[model samples]
Target: MDQKIIKVITGQRRVGKSYLLFQLIRLIQEREPAANIIYINKEDLEFSFIKTAEDLNKYVLANKVEGTKTYVFIDEIQDIENFGTALRSLLLKEDLDLYCTGSNANLLSGDIAGHLSGRYVEIEVYSLAYPEFLAFHKLAENNKSLDKYLKYGGLPYLIHLELEDEVVFEYLKNIYSSIVYRDIINRYSVRNTTFLEQLVLFLAAHTGSIFSAKKISDFLKSQRVNMAPNQVQTYIQHLVNAFLIHKVARYDLVGKRLFEIGEKYYFENLGIRNGLWGYRLEDRGKIMENVVYNHLLFKGYKVQVGILGNKEVDFIAEKDGEKLYVQVALTINNPDTLEREFGNLKNIPDNYPKKVVTMETFSGNTVEGIEAQDLRSFLLA
Candidate 1:
């Protein structure tokens, strides 16, 4: 808050970016009772006239308080053309504390970088984490609560709706459409809308599976939807850019390098994935993996799929120069299941923490030095 740098809050649409801005504003108001706040929401028709950079500058300047510092908050700033230019000019004034929210990941890339490099900071927002889900729904931690979380996922607005398939999925499908049609298809001027939706369905069904673009292309060809690997890769990139899904690269644990070919994709919001593809009992394993990946990200870890020899580790999470190995499974009740999950981590050379997260609660269970954690406890941690 003391810095002059602009706080750029970025996230997927409906992931609570505006809510975050409102929270910040509330905090500022509590701290500074006389704070001069200039708020502009592009989503609201009231700000429709402020389309260009000059118009934005004029409005902020016109609304400026005489002597006090102005705390300016712009919602959906990406909606305005040449908004970086206005932000750059407004940033010059020592009296303005600028903050803005954007739904696109590229908000700070390309032209925006040229205008506000080193003059801003980015804070990414995501759908609610598991702990947040429990708190938001006011549900106690148990099988039922966890099941609801796994099925519905955590979009903050979901709190308003009854947690039922018909009602929640209806809302989630609409959000999926907005993200797909408005964010990716419209922004990228996508030509093959049919293939795009099909690709999303493919991703939803095969959530944690690792495959190359060529592999996906080949599979699509078999389905009679022919798209070249390059084009398929481009469309996938569009989905990633839109923050609809996260693309996790595969890392070779032995060679200590990232693999170029295969990668795994997980949804940014699981509810959206479940909404697009029905949440079924058979997909429990994939759902568990996706849930683990999202939780790792929520904990601010840089996560990647790990490959060591023939064994595959679910996640190799790194943060602040430290690493953590994680494996997710439906259960380790079967002896083979227990060994496979822990055995993969045992082969890892270094001494960083290794854990196995499962559906069944097993307290203080350790295999050779690896800790075993239940899904709910792992999420809370």
Candidate 2:
């Protein structure tokens, strides 16, 4: 289906959306060479002239390739204003299979669907899931190698081990800047981007932890960079829009309550976060949780950071009639640590398949009624 359809691929930055689009185009070209594939990257300086719908129509006419199934591939198309209408017009009048890639979900939300109703399909792509990451880096499926993927995530371009750590960090830094400057600042006309940058750093430093914007504002205030709670909230939304951070709301299944009090965030790739800040093994739990979050999302589950009773489940995945309770920890370690993790699953008082995944151990057994499984095995399975 990924290759058969001409669809819009939306995902976080550096998550292989562009590359995936290119791959699909190549596949289509191999099948139908006479099928014209005109690729236009909106960020290109040559396409800078495409600011309005008229410009787009002219640009399309100038570069029009002749074929029965001409594949029109556009990348980062949100840069062009009123592009939705132009695309709608082209799709309506022409016999073209359209493929577009965007950095975020704005294309789906902001008038694109309304303008091009039932005209296109959307496919979401994500950063390398655990299995993909392992395959990309040619790493053995073991605790030690999975640890490396967790520490520095699987951004396809950075899979090479020969690249210096500093070089990788610099690349991530450039990506961070692109999201901040191009996606947020340029797209939203946000003033005083310093607060936004600080907010992202704060969120990245404390991923997987649930806290309110007011609490974050208070924390920022203590650092002498006092900003309003509303401002902090806006900054967080901006980051989420740019796809650098994902805010997961706490779902209280027992109480049947959806509270806006505390929300958790996960980075698109742990490598970028670890690169920006000094890496630490102590932060492995959040890194693993981030990996799992991306995995469940790519697997087509509606996932949430679960708040059940007094314990927090790392992920609550639901699809169709199935529900999964997940707990992510660095290791099953000693009895006490094991109890803490397994206890969270043990107390659920429901049979929804509880799992405790970690970097250690290959044994799969029932610990205190909670199924304990190694992270690598889960991915491979």
For all predicted structures, in order, the TM-scores are 0.96, 0.91
Identify the leading candidate in terms of TM-score.
1
The residue ranges of model 2 lying beyond 4 angstroms of the native Cα positions read: 1-6, 61-67, 160-163, 362-364
Off by over 4 Å in 1: none
Q: How close is candidate 2 to the true structure, as a TM-score?
A: 0.91
* Candidate 1 backbone collisions, by pair: none
Candidate 1 structure quality by residue, lDDT tens digits, 1-381: 857999999889999999889999999999998899999999899999999989999999999997889999999898788899999999999999999998777787754677888989989898999999999999998889999999999999999999999999999999999988888888789999999999999999999999899999999999999999999999999899788999999999999999999999999988899999999999999999999999999999999999999899999999999999999989888999988988899999999999999888887648988998989899998
Q: Write the per-residue lDDT of candidate 2 for residues 1-381, one digit (tens) a residue.
A: 323334788877778888887888889878877766778888789777778877876777667765465677888888778888778777764556678888866778875777766767888777788788778878787777776777667778877545456777788788888888988998889997888877877877798888899999999889998898888888888788777878888988788778878899988777888877657767777777788887778788888877777778888889998999988887777788888888888778678888888877656558766777777776766
